[model samples]
Target: MLLHMFFPSKCVTCGSFGKVLCVSCKNSIKPVTQDSCIVCYRNSINGQTHEICKKTSFIDNALAIIKYTGAGRDWIGVIKYKRAYSTISEVVSIFPQSWIQKFKKITQYYTNALIVPIPLHKQREKARGFNQSKKIAKEFSKITNIPTSCVLLRVINTPQQAKQPTKNTRKENIKGAFILKQGQVVKNKTIILIDDLYTSGCTAQEAAKILKIAGAKTVLLFTLAHGKV
Candidate 1:
C-alpha cells in the first residue's frame, strides 16, 4: 500500500516502522495510582491533603496515563531529554483509543475550558528550542478541538523537579516559580493542565494554585506518565 511505501511504519521505541510502539514495549508500561490529595493531587498515600496543600488550595483533580518507569520512562526520556520531536507523533499514535474516549468523556464535564501547559523558563525554552508541555498541549488540542493558552509564566527558572531528591525539596524548588500573566482572564473558567510527566506533582500543584488564586474555577491535571510519589 502507498501508506507503507513512504512511511515504513516503524516502532517509535525500536525503529520497527511497520507499527508505532511494539506490543512488547506497550505491555511493559503500566499505570499506577496512589491515594492523592483532592487539593494538590500529591500522593496522599498516608492520608488526605496536609496543611501545606490546603494552604495553597491547588488543583481539584489529576490523572496520569502511565507509570513513569520501564518503557514509560524511556519514551519520555527519549522525547524530552533527547529532543526527539518526530517521535512524538509516532509515540502519540500508539495511545489506546480508550484514552481519547476517556479524555472526551471527562472533558465534557468542563465546557469551554482552556487548556494550559506548565511554562518553562525563557532561557531553558530558548535553549531547548521548544516547550514539550506546550507541544503536547497543542497536539492534544488539535485532536480535541480545545483551545490552548500558554499564559502561565515561569518568571524565574528553578532546578528541574526530576533532579530534586525529596518531595519537600521539589515543593520548595518550584515555589514562586510560576505566575499567571497579567490581564489574562481565567476567572470562573475551568482549566486543564497538560504535561508530559508527573512525578512529585509539585510543579503542577504550584501552578494550579496560582491559577486558582487568580480566580480560576478549577484546575485539573493530566500527564502522559507518572511515578509513585
Candidate 2:
C-alpha cells in the first residue's frame, strides 16, 4: 500500500493521475455490441456456437467485454507485458453493470460450473511471475461467485499464436498442447474458460477440447478483449 501511495496511479490512456483508467477513457472504450459464434465468428445469439458450427469446435459459447483496440488494447498490454496487475481491477471496474448481470445470469443456468483460465507453460508463467488469464479469472469468479480451477496444463511450449502466419498454423500449433491434470475430474461440469485476449482463438479452442474430452458438459469462454480475426 505504501508503494501505491509513493507512486500513485495514472490513467493508462490519458496519463491522468489518481485512477488507472480515467472516467473519460473508461467510457470511451467500446463494448462488443453484437454477439458472434465462437467457431465461425458469424452472428449468433449470446455468442453461442451455431448449431451447424458445433461439429467443428468444442467451445459452447464465447464472450468478451471490450474490443481489442485503443484503450482496451493498451489496458491488456499493461497487465500482460508490463506487470501492472492493479490494472486488472481497474478494467473490471469499468465493465458495464449490464454485462456483469448478464454473466451472473448465464452462470445460473448451470448447476455445476467451474471457472478455468487458459494456462501458460510453466517456464513462461514462472518468468512472467503470474498467469494473466488466471488473475483475470480470479477477478471474474469474485464477481460471479463461481469457483476457479486449473484443470488443464500446457504440456507443449509452442510458438505464440500471434506469431503464427495463418489461422491454420495457429490451430495446428496449439493442437495437443494441453492435457488434463492427473486425478482432476471435470466430468459433468460446465466450465467458464477465462483469458486475457481472444485473437485466433486457437489457444482457447485447444484448451476447451481437452476439457470436453474429459467429460465437461459445456465450455464457455470469457475473454477481456476481442481482437480482429
Candidate 3:
C-alpha cells in the first residue's frame, strides 16, 4: 500500500509503530466507570447527586471519548494549539467506536440528529484563524455522514472557560453568551452538540439549552474528552 509506505502508522503520543495510539496509551485514557449518574456523568462527587443533573433533564445525553488528562490532555493541546490536524484523524480513528454505537442503541429517539459545533465569536475566530470545534464537527460529519449546522453563533465574546477556575463562574460566564443565528435550519431537528472537551459540562449544557429553546427537538452532547470537574 503506497499510503502505508509514506505514513509509518505510529502512535501520535509515543511514536511507536503499528497503531495511531499504541495499545498501552489507549488503555491509559479509559473513561471512568464507577457507576456514574447518567446526567452529569459525575459519580456522586458531592455525597449527593447534583441538582442540575436530575433525571428528566433538559439536555438529553452527553458522551465523551476519554478522561481529559495524561495522553488525552497532550493530544487535545497539540491538536488545538500546535496545528496538529493530522492527529485528528489518528484520534478519531482510535475513538471508542463501541461506546458510540451503544449510545445510539439507547438514544434511538434521536435517530436523525444533525451535528452542531458550538461557535466562537467572530473576533475570537478571526484571532485564532479557525474554530477547533468546527474542524472536529467537519471531520465527524465526513466520517459519519451526519449533517453539521453552523446554525448557532456566539454573538458576544466572553472570558475563556479554561482560564476560569470556579464551576459557578464558568456557568455564569456563558449565560446569554450564544445565540441561534437568523436561520430556520435547526427547527424540528434533533441536534448533536460537539465540542473538544467537557469540563463542568456547562458550555455543552448551555448550548443544548439554547438549541432546545430554538425548537430543536432534542440536543445531545459529544466531546473528545472530559476533564476533572
TM values, all candidates: 0.80, 0.91, 0.77
Task: Name model 3 segments beyond 4 Å from true.
Answer: 1-28, 31-39, 43-57, 103-108
Identify the runs in model 1 with alpha carbons over 4 angstroms from their true place. Answer: 1-27, 31-57
lDDT of 1 by residue, 36-74 (tens): 664555576322355677665577666666777877787
Model 2, span 1-229: residue lDDT tens: 9777434488778899977777887778888888788778888888889989989989999989888899888777777765677767777877789988888888888889999999999998988788999989999999889999998999998888888988899999999999999999999999999999988888999999899989999999999888866
Cα lDDT of model 3 overall?
0.70
Q: Model 2 misses residue 45 by how many Å?
A: 1.4
Candidate models: Cα lDDT each: 0.75, 0.87, 0.70
Clashing pairs in 3: none
Which number leads on lDDT?
Answer: 2
Kindly report which residue stretches of model 2 are placed more than 4 angstroms away from their true locations once superposed.
1-23
Name the better of 1 and 3 by lDDT: 1
The weakest ten consecutive residues by lDDT in model 2 span 2-11
Please state the error at residue 186 of candidate 2 in Å: 0.7
Ranking by lDDT: 2, 1, 3
Query: Cα RMSD (Å) between model 3 and the true structure?
Result: 5.6
- Which scores greater on TM-score, model 1 or model 2? 2
